[model samples]
Target: MTEKVIALDIGNVCIGIHPERCFGALGFRSLADIPREVLFLAGERFERGEISEAEFLDGFRRLTGSALSDAELRRAFCAIIGEPVPGMAELVSGLAGRGYRPVFFSDTSVTHMEELRRKFPAASAVPDGIYSYRVHAKKPELPMFEAFEARFGVPAFYFDDRAELIEGARKHGWNAHRFVSAEEVDKILG
Candidate 1:
């Protein structure tokens, strides 16, 4: 039998992420305090590896007019990453034991990815990954889906917290689901 391929999103699906924590760590009281250019444009560019890490930090400082040092900026940015989702590591192992090849499909920056790998076992459990930084495209984009199809031949199933990303996977002819909880994934996989 052909091995079943399953794509799992890393951010909110495998590891909990709280962007508010990052903003708070950076001394922002509310989301409104962050500029759209810094939050969206610079972030997306960083995730896509269009800019170097140093450049991203420089842009952030220039845009926000903050006095944070490079190390402080990195720490604040990585603060968004939390612990791995409960039971997600075991679920990943279970998927492997059940003959499902689990792979990470995510849009994440280098700093966030490094933090996740260092802190979350589940985030590193899956050996295979197709990241936006490497792919040069983010989710909800055609290029990401195309890259997945080109590499893995269209995943048998894809799970993500975002409905828009799920729709993107579906458009690529994959069975995609909005990930809610590990229990929901267990039921679906079983």
Candidate 2:
């Protein structure tokens, strides 16, 4: 059997928003500043490749009417990210080293995504075939998983933090995990 694993990290803002993950000078804030409609539109634009990072922020500001600096909002969103989820990245990377593949499936929007690319070294770890908001479609929706299967074939395991998403994956006859920690992954893999 092919022992590849397509590990997914989800986020409205990012996979993990823990403070230490913050790189530049920052302050903690929440998505309260931006509207769901605005974020959704940003995702569409990101997927369409029609706007730049600066354009996304300007439009988002106009949509939200919030005066918070982008830098502050970035810090707040980043702060919400829980710390590494205890060896989550390592576990995925270890699996990859052993011939398993790890894919980051997300529903993150365009503006936040630009921040994500700068926050994490995902480009080097996961393949470019990642499904993000820019790609349209979100988790808990079967089409994204279908696309994943189409691109990476079936993974030995598909892990996601969202139990709802996991349930959807299992429906497709895929072994899915409600990723809590590396320990859970170890338990399932072992």
Indicate which candidate wins on TM-score: 1
lDDT of each residue in 97-178, candidate 2, tens digit only: 6776777767655555555556554445765455555445666577777777777777777777777878987887888878
**Candidate 2 residue-wise lDDT at 172:** 78
lDDT of 1 by residue, 1-190 (tens): 5679999999889999888998999999888889999986446899998988899999999998999999999999999999888878789877867888888899998888899888877554577888898889998888888887788878888999998888877877789999989999999988
Pairs with backbone N, CA or C atoms under 3 Å apart (clashes), candidate 1: none
Best by lDDT: 1
Candidate 2 regions with alpha-carbon error over 4 angstroms:
1-3, 12-15, 18-55, 67-82, 110-123
Cα misplacement distance, residue 44 of candidate 2 (Å): 7.4
**TM-scores for every candidate against the unseen true structure:** 0.94, 0.69
Error of 1 at 16 (Å): 0.6
Clashes of each: 0, 6
lDDT for each candidate structure: 0.86, 0.60
What's model 2's overall lDDT?
A: 0.60
Candidate 2: residue 16 Cα off by (Å): 2.0
